[model samples]
Target: MNKALPVILICLLLFQCDSGKDGLPANSQLLRNTDISLSPDSFSPWVPVTNDGFSLGISQETFLSGNRSLFIENQDSLNVNAALWRQTYDGPMPSEGRRLTLRAHLKGENIELKSTGSNIYISVRMFPVEDSEGTTINRFLSSQNRFRIFGTFDWEPLAVSIPSFPKDVEFITVYLVMGPRTTGKVFFDDITLTVE
Candidate 1:
C-alpha cells in the first residue's frame, strides 16, 4: 500500500534486461568454439600450431562433445617441441583485481613428459587496450605450472588461473600446450574462460 513502493516496482518492470547473443544472459559466455564444432579450414577462430614434426587440426575422430575436438599429434618420440592450439579473444575484460580462469577437457594418448619442468597447461595472455610508455600498465601472461597432466589420460579437465589485470585490458590470448618432450596425441574440447 506504499505509493513509493508501487512506483519503484513499475520502473523495474519496465526495464529490459540485456539478453546476449544466442539467448544467453548478459554475463553468460558462449566462449568461442573451443569445442571445435564450428566451421574449419577457412573461418574457424581456433588456429593450429605445431613444430616441424607435429600436426594439428580439428579432428572428428575423438571428442567430448559435438562430435569434434582439436588435436595436436607428434609421432617422433625424439621431438622436443610443443604442439598447441591458440585462440585470441577480444571478449569483455574484467575489472581491476578480478581473477581469470581457463578450463577445458583434454584427452591424451601416449603422453610422456621427459622433464618435470614441463606441463600440459593452458597459457593465457591479457593485453591492454593501449600501452602508455613509462606507465606501470603492461601485458600479463601466465601458464599456471602447478597444474599438470602426463603419461596417458582419458578425457579429463584442466584449469589454469592467472592474476587480475588493470583497467586497460581489452583482449586475451589462450594456448593449449602439449609438450616439449612428449610423443602423443592430445585432444582439447569444451574450453572456457571465466572472469571472477
Candidate 2:
C-alpha cells in the first residue's frame, strides 16, 4: 500500500503543475486590491497615508468597477501640491533576461501638472537585497519601461514591459505613482504584475 501511495502522489503533482513560458516558476500575481473594493485594507499593501507637507487623500467611491474603485486626490489649503500612491512587491528578484510586465486600468479627470517632473505611471522598481539583513535599495529603475498617463481620459488599459534586469537584483517593487503637485481625481482598478 505504501509503495502505491508514493506513485499516486507523484502522478497528481505532475498533473497539477502549472507555469508560464519562462523556465522560472511562474509568479502571475504581484498586486492586491485589484478590484478597488471598499475593504478597509483594499489598499493595505499601498500606503495611503499622506506624505511630506502635501495633503494626499485616498477614498472609496463608486464609479468604475462593481462596488467601488480606488480614488486618489490631492487637496491642499491653497491647491493640491502633491498626491501619490503606489503598490510595491518585495521578494526574490526576477531572473536575468526575463520578461517582466506591469498592467493597470486607469481613468483621470482634470489631471493637472504642477511641476516639471510630475507624471503618472505604472512602473517597476528593482531593488537588490543581498541578504536577509541587507537594506533593499533601488538597483534598477525602469525608466522607459512604463505606462504614462496624463490629462483627462476615460477608462483605458495601460501596460508596459521590461526585457530583463541584472542578476544581482534580489527584490522588486511595482509603483502606481500619481503625479505630484497635481489636482483632480484618478481612478484605479485591475492592476497586475507578471513575469513570463
Candidate 3:
C-alpha cells in the first residue's frame, strides 16, 4: 500500500500542474479563463467611433500619450443619447473559458447623475462570426448593468466579471461602454481582460 501511495501522489501533482497552465484552480467550478491585459500592447485592430450622432476621444493625457485610452462623446437627445467604443479580434480564445473580468482606470468631469447616471461603466463581449448585429456570442460585462462611480479626476480601478458562456469560445470581441443617456464626459485607461 505504501508503494501505491507514491504513484497516486504523482498523478495528483500532474493533474494540478496541467490545470494551473490554463489559469484555473484544480477544482474550479468555472471553465478556464485568461486575462487579456497580461499582454497590454496586443489589443490592436480597434474600431474608432465616427458616427456623426456620437462623439469620441481619448480619455486622458497619460492614456492618450500611451496611445491606449478610448473616449465616448455623449450626445444627449430625447431619442439618441449614447457613445460606444468597440473592437473585435479573429484569433481563437479558450472555448471552454467561462468568464471575463474587465479591469480599467476611470475619471470624469462635471459628472452629473442625471446627464450620465451616477456611475461610469465598462464591458467586454465575445461574438461568433455568423452572428447578426444584435446577437452576441457571450456578454462579459455591461456598464448599464455593472459599474463603479467616481466624481473627480482621480484614477479609480474597477473590475466586473460575467459568466454567460463556457470556455469553448472562438473569436472574441471586447467593448467598453459608458453612459445610459447622460451628457457628462468620462475618461478610461489601462483596459485589461483576465480569464480564470
Q: Pick the candidate with the highest TM-score.
A: 1
lDDT of 2 at 113: 63
TM-score of candidate 2 against the unseen true structure: 0.66
Model 2 is weakest, by summed lDDT over 10 consecutive residues, at 136-145
Q: Candidates' lDDT values, in order?
A: 0.70, 0.61, 0.53
Per-residue CA lDDT of candidate 1, range 110-181, in tens? 776666654567777666535454334435444546666776888998776655555555577788887776
How close is every model to the real structure, measured as TM-score? Answer: 0.74, 0.66, 0.60
Question: For each predicted model, how many residue pairs clash, with residues at least 3 apart or on different chains?
Answer: 0, 2, 13
**Whole-structure CA lDDT of model 2:** 0.61
The true-versus-predicted C-alpha distance at residue 128 of model 3, in Å, is 3.6
In terms of lDDT, the best-performing candidate is 1
**Residue 78 Cα positional deviation in candidate 2, in Å, after optimal superposition:** 7.8
lDDT of 2 by residue, 69-162 (tens): 5666654324434455566776655555677777777789777666655656666766543424553333434432244456789888787776
Better of 1 and 3 by lDDT: 1
Kindly indicate the candidate among 1 and 2 with the higher lDDT.
Answer: 1
TM-score for candidate 1, please give it: 0.74
Poorest stretch of ten by lDDT in candidate 1: 17-26
